[model samples]
Target chain A: MSATYTAAATLPEALAALASGARPVAGGTDLVVGARQGKAPLPDSLVAIHGLAELRGIAETGGGGLRIGALVSHADLVAHPAVRERYTALADASAIVGSHATRHVGTLGGNVMNASPAMETGGPLICFGAEAVLVSESGERRVAVADLLTGPGRTAARPDELLVAIELPAAAGGSCYARLEYRRQMEIAVVGATCAVTLEGARIGSARVAITALTPRIVRVPDAESALAGGDGGAGAVQAAGDAAAAAAQPISDVRASADYRRAMAAVIARRAVTAAIARARGSSDSVPIPASPALHGADRD
Target chain B: MRYDAVLNVNGTDFPVEIEPHRSLLSVVRTELGMPGSKEGCDDSECGACMMLLDGRPVNSCSYLALQADGRKIVTVEGLADGGELHPLQRQFLAQGGVQCGFCTPGMLISAKALLDQNPAPSEDEIRIALSGNLCRCTGYQGIVRAVQAAAAEIA
Candidate 1:
């Protein structure tokens, strides 16, 4: 048997429902799958917030940034023209998640809230300086995306808190995400890296490098970020940054791959991701391939 | 406790009393007696339970029935009209896409979703669209031809 369910029609209703101690469900891609597998029984009560109109959309923040609602489906993210032109890394990450069917059904909020260490969105979100906005009966608080997850399958969000949306700063320059997987599509990332570089004249002004699945949790490679900050965006400097990222990675041997192999692949992937980001920052076309999840020909766009 | 909900399936609505844990696939098959959708690897790894939710394909095995309340659902049964086979189904039969037939319903639903979004897709696009749906028989050659043929007819 499973827990009871409640559908919240409004934000206040959802918050009120959460007050009664119910697990918040949006998209239900992860929760329903986990429930079916008996990973954990469905909580005593589940509050569905998917129908709340307030929780869905991608909007431009007054500050010239973007506020992506928690319920924005991955399909929506990939097809957004603003996202493709600016937040290319986030777009690339969203495009590669699962298959077209899953992307149509999964939400960005669910991906971050699930707090999976190997999640494709986590690395890109952290590199782009994103923030998570959570609401509860006590009110709302904003937390840095990097600080949202404390461990695998764990989050800093309180039991009563609902992640309302994710806010991202204006895209600075060229950014891209790349992951190493056994298959080309529909596979979990073994080792992934995301890079956002702002070229200052001939030198790199600012750079952020983040890696996933190679540690207990996804983390920003500050050592690598600093190493590439003022250097020329050349192959030599990129190789050094990759070395730093590999050194910072703390991976454990698992059924997927050995620790040594993961550590080595982390460096290789970081190098490739940084190279692509640098190319895009220099006003080059995106080097990442589109996953065909969203057909641009259709008139159904936001 | 069972709650009453209305599920609009294939242009018709069926009111059902279901538990919170019941999946859309279970209710559609057991409660509504429309087994056009199959239950493969219930965890969503297999696409045998694929169905259209509000014009988008999803794994019904992992989708809660209550979550689908008031939403339009299209199963494999809905692909045909007035006993006439859908072009994709016709092509599948002609191109040998139906081998084991166990994976046909899901494959047809996935193909229908793809064709709806993209009337004419390349071989690579078709492969990527059907990547989620797996078939151990026919080696995907016939399936690929079936989709291409259907697209040609639709275009």
Candidate 2:
């Protein structure tokens, strides 16, 4: 527990801290836990950015989009009315990230930057076409969330470039996120899907499907998009979309689940998510069917 | 190197110098001697180190003490009003919610947060609120009942 700690009071101070070799800490739900688990030692210089109110709330962009600060926690996202009303998928993903305690401390910026293949936020961010705003002493850059990930536990962000905010473009459709977990709490996704659907009358105008835990990283399934385009938002098209998503997944066998099971669940979850998203888009349903917790029984019980 | 910061806990501020690697829970228990918040898991897995950071329940073990500067924290020790216990504590004791007492602090804090938001929470809401605070003892029957009982009394 011996390391330098600097609490930055302003944006420029934070950038200076970053430039001076201090690793930014927001929430520290991942970094602190990772350190304790011996994943890595605490950085020699730590910059505490949680005190920066400038980097902490959800705001509206001039372009009818949403700007989520880098320090915004998962709990904040779930409770925000804008997030719930506009980006329900982000709210859904935020609600089930770890437990209430972890969610209270885990920030959306942290989740995205963690770049875990099974990270709950990535799928929805990719599906919604969110952009990450990276800032440093030299200036700022915005990168599409889809292109932010280089690999597992890695991002394209430079060490000096701190993620300051995530900007999500306004969506014409309704979107929802679903993750398949074994336990009710503190369980990572076995497979997850986030779907956004824009309906032109009864036919799908456009659809975006992103799957998680079924590959090295959360990825959009273009095949599913192809299947969903121009088709009526009906059972048949939805099922085919799911099938395409399953076909696109490159899941590997792991301790959490089998490659075969993940691939199959990816399809089922995609179907359910897309179906629900379409319902929300058409204004038929105000409620999303994503379970807040694990079902009481297992697959074998039934 | 170390950081000098003021941790506002239970309506009182304590000035301390701590390393960046040190957790808020460590500072609370070791430096301030408020051991009410137990450390069940050094990671965020267990909620034994749960505390209210700005009235929201968070795992203090994974929270850096320096990050808590200027933020108000409420630990289990702060839940009592001098000799009188908070309603959650009273109900927890009355309903036998305490078994090993490790998860009690976290359960109480999380319950407080839930009640703060929704005074009349449903049974399902209570379960979801305390989902982070695991209890290996009492089957969670007592804890759930205690929260329900408290909510009814307050209502």
- Model 1 bad stretches (over 4 Å): A287-302
lDDT of each: 0.87, 0.86
- The interface root-mean-square deviation of each model, in the order shown, is 1.8, 1.5
State the lDDT of candidate 1 residue by residue for A106-208, as single tens digits. 8999999898889989998999889999999999999998999888989999988999999998887888888887654456678988899998898999999
DockQ-based class of model 1: medium
What value does the lDDT take at residue A39 in candidate 1?
A: 77
Across residues A88-171, which tens digit of lDDT does each residue of candidate 2 receive? 888888888888778877889899998899988898899889999999999999999999987888899998888999999987
* Candidate DockQ scores, in order: 0.64, 0.72
Assess the local accuracy of residue B77 in candidate 1 as a C-alpha lDDT between 0 and 100: 92
Q: What lDDT score is found at residue B19 in candidate 1? A: 88
User: Where is model 1 chain A poorest over a 10-residue stretch in terms of lDDT?
Assistant: A293-302
What is residue A254's positional error in candidate 1, in angstroms? 2.8
